[model samples]
Target chain A: MTATLAIGPYNQSERPALEESFNAHVVADPSEAAGMDPAARSTIKAIAYKGHLPFGGAEMDLFPNLGLVANYGVGYDAIDVDAANARNIRVTNTPDVLNDDVADLAIAMWISQGREMRQAEAWVRDGKWASDGAYRLNRKVSGGKVGIMGMGRIGRDIADRLAAFKTDVHYHARSEKQTPGWTYHADPVALANAVDFLFVALVGGSATEKYVSKEVIAALGKDGVVINISRGSTIDEDALLDALEIGAIAGAGLDVFVGEPDLNPRFLALDNVVLQPHQGSGTVETRAAMAKLQRDNVAAHLAGGDLLTPVN
Target chain B: MTATLAIGPYNQSERPALEESFNAHVVADPSEAAGMDPAARSTIKAIAYKGHLPFGGAEMDLFPNLGLVANYGVGYDAIDVDAANARNIRVTNTPDVLNDDVADLAIAMWISQGREMRQAEAWVRDGKWASDGAYRLNRKVSGGKVGIMGMGRIGRDIADRLAAFKTDVHYHARSEKQTPGWTYHADPVALANAVDFLFVALVGGSATEKYVSKEVIAALGKDGVVINISRGSTIDEDALLDALEIGAIAGAGLDVFVGEPDLNPRFLALDNVVLQPHQGSGTVETRAAMAKLQRDNVAAHLAGGDLLTPVN
Candidate 1:
């Protein structure tokens, strides 16, 4: 039997599980696979993948026996699904398993930004609290109007958590969901205008690219805050940067940014924003679950069983 | 009729309301009242008070006609309630009005600490994410065991919010209340042992001093996070500092501190902790509501009517 290929940088703690599950041929990137002998490459039947590097038809053509691409995270925008479908190559992504973790992070970021927690922490750390008496008052998060873009599984989870805080939840989706009492707006701008806080929870793809446009951001008004736990491509980075620079919006809590890890340097200069690395689903338990789900999909595919969570 | 003394530094925006409501005599501090004529001081009957300064019989004695001490915040720890009761002076505090804000902070702190948001933010801001790839995985907050130190109004609010996040809510209170599904432990240490996150929401005072003791801190074990939204006196800061310094516990999210603004400098050195200035109830909406309630109490007392939300 051919070995399964495990791609991306898996830390010491996580790599063992992959090694135990399969006769794994680990590579840092797809290009590295080219260095291997043709016979070994031909033997690759499955790939356990992580990271945001684009893996398209070109990479797919490398392995003639490739049957499965088990993605290690919920969002698999990096995987060219259309190309995989054309080749009858199955692609499975870890989804619902990471919903709670991502939702938790979105809610945390919203509350943290609203409460000005970062600045408040600095006030205490710098000993300004003692000399200054009380820190300046911040905006209240509870009872505020909140708008969620894309009412998917993770979006619903974020809404559920916000509802507990007594927020009036509003959302913009392809179609109105079955959630009662939550106001639905067809236009994203209308949703933005109605909310003091707008959370981006749309899926990552060209269809949703720049969905949170300049008009939508401007509609949020001066006191409004934007929170993004979704893919960075869902927002227009230039518009967001401009708005944040001039204080057009109150602040933002961003976990994802366009070309993140190498996001726009301008974001680093803003004190009004709370910047987080793309870590919405970065938790030990969630990541472990994701890795397990990814591995399980590969195992099932090799056994000629049904793919667990097929994206294609 | 004498004027009501509005103490503490009320900003221009808030001062107008106090002036409009009372024949107001504004003073920066209690000692500043000494500059006033005896007639003016003797005629003062009500105080619209803010700040952490202790207000006892001695201060009350300055104004022979003093009948009401209207506190502008929820916690009345600094006000000598027994002395007020003995002097037949009515004491009122702003409560319930700030419950959501304080509870929001407590919940936010819990999630922030568990998710390691502060460090995550730094990873993005400091350009470590681009250089170091993905930030390290953090502990999941949802579905974790949570402990509330006191089951007061704020504690109940915290529990209600945590329940929505799927947390197994555990608490230590004076006695069990009517809360269903939540596990209550009579001993604080037992409660600490049962939870991954412990929140301090007890009332402030000597009676509850060091309520979260060294034993409770140790019982929390490793991977435990302490979140304090209550008074700093509720926890043994020395024990907490020791635990944080030695990695005895995972981390802490603290809003209040012992001698805050001048808190133990050791906290600033620790990267694992998220320190916030005492601003749990410091939101514009809540503070405005608190000020209104405080003024309402003073107005009621002046009219020989019932004091609103009276402590004594």
Candidate 2:
């Protein structure tokens, strides 16, 4: 029986790399592990994991000999870290490698939403430019006030990029950071009110679930735009949907949702919102880096070295 | 008779400001001036012009007392400068004010095309994410090589913005510019070949017509993306269409087209392109500034002062 188990529907390009490094057993999800022979499950010492499915103690119990679970993404919200800790199982996630791609997407979405590039493109493709005379003038994005929620590594990266565009950067973090010139808001609602564009860059997990609440969304105002590159759980999706539907907020550029891939159907009808399939770090370069980090963590655990990026 | 003629269809918001500033006669186009009574035509000393219709010596002849043509846009290509010079007419354009908006759009378009953001948006909106799983990974835009075809003010602004993203900024100009640290290629093809993204920001006129020629486009290679915020005539549109059709180049983000407003229908069919209706400088703030600048130039000319932004 293979000592390693790789889970999730990884693509052809990613599969070869995992196969080369480990004698592995591949499964689509945790349910598949339950169906495996008892001896085969007992043999699994490490799990290479991806996807947003919850992996709790029940799944860990199925693999009696499981030692480590290496997550493919920066966010380890789906991995039950507490359960892993209780079971004396180690957990690690790929981080930092995807910061540039996520930051780029956040900035791109902000510009796209502000400039109405999606609708502008459709207007040209539909022959409206010739018949319609001129495309409607949009709002300027640069030199505007920008607020970043959760001044983590990704948040700082986004703020850095926005600073280059000459935007007045504001942020809300757990505590005051040493960032010079950037205004720090103790409250998220205050940060939202102060900015023309608000970017959600908080981490995932229960602590940050619905961190951007109804009050925060409302404070952003009618001229404000929201750009979320963080997990969908960071925002109160119902409040966001209502704000978008009635024009309480000018627009939203969402890369994540509360139940994404299976995101709310209401988002499908919005012309003001630029929707992306939770692809903040879905770039060839970034994904490759993330995969490498995930494998490195697993390799370190197997070789009796420190876990590369431990969560538990 | 009015001292100024505000030509082209001015919006309600803009028309009031012009009327408040000047004793102005508003006409739709050059042909409308021809239809006006001889007294009205002869009385027109300054024309506050907008639109892409040809305004030449023939049009200038109608306004026997015309001293100034204060163009509402930076590109005064539609107004023949030589014709204005032959008739001893001074031409002024609103420049510098619209640079930030245009540069913003160029950067937005480059990021959009490189990330395949249009398709990514549709994939999420059309419920493909749930059915098709994750959207395919796209190319990362930041930290790539970017070429500026013309290193003028707007181009320099674009380079400055791209530099923040850590891109290698290379440029081609008639002569070497004072841009320290940025690579300068004497030849356009060489510049194109050296970059992943090419931005066209040259001034519009016959001298620069087809400046981004077929050779330059080909040299950009298959992984290269072209972003044009300059005038339609700056690029060889036919060659561009062919390259896009055959996948000879990766993609294009075109805000201007040959004979646009009436751009080629072939562009509509291509998924690799992101089309914009030449709204590079079309922003509420920027347009207002442009209108104010145009009015200022005319006011200066009417008061027997030097033209604010004279073309010839």
Candidate 3:
């Protein structure tokens, strides 16, 4: 029997991996493939969705007839695990494969801000260095304090990178950690006050919404820097701006945002912040590996084996 | 017996140090105190002169009676060393103390560019990270190659910083080095081609005029970055602009310029560089330490012991 498979928002990079593991491919936009419209999505027997469609979308109803849904990456926010469970449809996400890449990007962001890298590049590329001189007023990165928000795999990796700088690492989490050389604070506020640089690596959604608010930002104080590789909603944007304008905090480095594409105009004016067009897991090596893992998950589910990375 | 002293641009920071060492303090702007104008020079019995007048306007002939002239810092470009030698005035320069501080700024610039730091800061502080949704873009620093233009103490310290990054250190010097972990390249062009990043730590003078010319810049190609913390005059400014415009080289970090405080407007438009106000050794800690060292050198000279850091 030929099993029908619905492809999600993932690009062609995952094509080979998908073909290798699945029998029949239904390459449609997730919205269309998940029977977005009652009449359109009834054709698919199983689904493989990616970045499109939130977990509570109309497409989730199709899971009743679907056997499995393989997510493209570790963040399975777009797929509804609860709905899939009720319908007996298994859901899986690619997690372990992306840890290193995300961690590497996170570290790169931290160093980039600590060193004022892009400005350095502009200095030389603009010939200001040759004309006026370079690094005449640069800052130091060694012996700086690094605070990690959310103690997890990626956060630990960032700490590893900080070791080279001889930096002190502090972590803020719901629970305290017993890790040596790492000081644990009860929350982000206490942690922000004690560190020179703060990094956010926790999960997204309501539980963490606006966790870094005015109180937390004020604790960071002047000369303090923040880096967010976690969800943007965790931070209070308005509070952060107030801190930056009044010198309550020094600067920040971010890879995630709230409204996104429709970014805030005020952010465009600040030189203390660094901007990137989100591509954390976009590395050639990491993206390919993630695609492969998703493929493997699909193969395992079809072969009557347990899903590799189930989204409980 | 009265003694005269020439102080060239020596601010309050250097005053205390000089007072501790010298038995008599007769301060003259080096340009005027050195008797630059025969008619303006005072026929003092004995005096010490500073290297030069502020902005090169002072007449050096203010104090003709000076027996000893102590150089403040490593570079003696403002002092007429030949004239001092003719007068049998012993000249001393404070060197070793400031090497580590300058080197720290240089390496910090290097790593900042390699990591694209300024952009990262802009992303977060500007709140773009929160508004842009998801994004990840930063350069890696761990395994890149490092090249030094001059193999001096500062260059050595820079190489030491590279140890953590696991970089292969290469240097272009007048002669080969016996230092470990550094391979010497006799020519600047060869060195530029052999490394991912090139750092200029060479002295500025006739012998090293425009050493980093268009030829050397071309050799670095598109992927290589150049960092100059030594002196602006050591590089060919015109050549650097051309290279940057054509993308012949990736980027640069500069702390010194040919004619500073009057930066080129051309550089103001580029987005690939970092600019500073030439405060490499501006840190409070480093500056104080530098002042202390100069003072010690002056004290040793006054006591008739050999100068601590004599240039000749």
Candidate 4:
């Protein structure tokens, strides 16, 4: 039997399981994926993919027998679904498994920003607390109004968690959801204006790129904060940086960033913001579950069964 | 008329309010009190004390006409209550007002520790994320068992918040109350052993000193995390440091410490711990409420009205 091809920088522990289950051949990314012997590539029927590095029809054309692409995360924006659909390639993703982890992080970042947890921790570590009597008072987070940009699964999870924080959940979606007590705004700018915190939980990819526009950030005025757990593409980076620099918005607690890992250096200089290295769903339990689900989908494809979590 | 004496490092915003409310005489601390004239000392009938500085018989006796010690925080451990009782001096504390802020910090710290928020933020801030890949996977916080050491107002609030995070709430108090669906541990060690996270919210005083003892710390095995939002005296700090150093416990997120401001050097050296500068109630809204409550108690006393939140 030929092998299942795995791509992207997977954890070392995941490699063994991938190989043992499907006789998988792993490579760094698409760059190394090219120029594989035609015979080896032709035999590969399923691809277990990780990371968002565009896997369009051009990449799919290399593997003649490829029937399925199992993505390692909730978002499959990197996979050109339209291209795959034309070529009759099925797509599966790992979702719901990471919702708890992502929501936990979103709430953590929001609370950290409001309470000055970052600077306060530094004061304790750097002996400033010993010298200075008390840290300066910060504004409260609980009992504030929050605007969620999207009302999808992850957005709902974040809203549910923040609901426990005693925040009024106002939201913007394509249309209003059946969220009884939560106020819905048709326009994103209106939602931003109504809330003290703007929590971005929109889907990633080109369609929603810069969805959290300059107007929305502006509506979230001098006392408003922005907390993004969704993809960085959802927000306009330049506008956010300008607002943060000029104090047009109060502060931010960001996880995902545009061109992440190599994000804008301007974010590093801001004293008011709390920045994290895109670890929203980066937890041991959630990652393991995501990996297992990804493999399960691949296994289903090999066995000619239905995909576990098919995106398309 | 004689003025109400305010002591400890009150905020700049609070100073004016204090002066406006009672013609308040502000002093840094007790160190500055010893050399005051007898007439001035006698005039200070009520001391709006704000810190844990052993306001005992000696300090109370300094003011010959001292009738009240209104504490600026929920904990009145600093006030020698027995001594105050003997001298017929009433004690009042600012409570309920700070519960939301304290609980929010506890949950924030717990989630931050579980998700490695501190280290992850550092990875972004220090340009390590650009150099490295994603932050190393951390354990998930939601769906874990959390043991709250006390079931008081603040503890209840923490439990309520964590409940929303999908945690199973197990708590230990003097006697089990009417909390349905939550496990009640009679002993601290059992509570520590039963949960992955041990949250300290016990009342602060000699009775509860070292309540989270060496044995309890030991019971909270290698994977256990400790989150303290209560007073420093609730837990044995030395045992906590030793456990964190040797990995007897996974990590700690501490808001309070013994001899706070100047905590043990051992804590500063540990990377596994998240040290906060006692900012549980340090927010603009909450602190203002606390100050107003403290003043309200003083005002009630002057009006010969009922004390709002009296201790003794």
Tens digits of per-residue lDDT for model 3 on A125-170?
5666556643433345556788888887667766765665557888
Off by over 4 Å in 3: A1-53, A56-59, A63-141, A151-153, A172-190, A213-215, A263-312, B1-142, B151-153, B156-190, B213-215, B261-279, B282-312
Residue B92, candidate 3: C-alpha displacement in angstroms = 6.1
Best by TM-score: 4
Could you tell me the lDDT of residue B183 within candidate 1?
96
Each model's DockQ? 0.85, 0.81, 0.16, 0.88
State TM-scores per candidate.
Answer: 0.97, 0.98, 0.70, 0.98
Where does model 2 exceed 4 Å of error?
none
Model 4 interface CAPRI class:
high
Clashing pairs in 1: A130-B261
Higher-ranked by DockQ: 1 or 2: 1
DockQ, candidate 2, comes to 0.81
TM-score of chain A of each: 0.98, 0.98, 0.89, 0.98
| CAPRI class of candidate 3 | incorrect
lDDT tens string, model 4, A118-213? Answer: 899988888898887688888799999998999998989889888887888999999888885899999999999999898898888888999999
Instruction: Rank the models by lDDT, top first.
Output: 4, 2, 1, 3
lDDT over C-alpha atoms for residue A214 of model 4:
94
Per DockQ, the best of the predicted structures is 4
Ranking of models by DockQ: 4, 1, 2, 3
User: What are the lDDT scores of the predictions, listed in order?
Assistant: 0.89, 0.90, 0.66, 0.91
Give every collision pair in model 2. none
lDDT tens digits by residue: candidate 1, A1-312: 446998887877668888888968888877787677888889989999988888889888888999999988888998999999988899999999998889888888888888899888878877788887678888899999999999999999999999999999999999999996899999999999999899899999888999999999999999889999998999998999999999899989999989888999999999888898988998889988988899999999989999999998
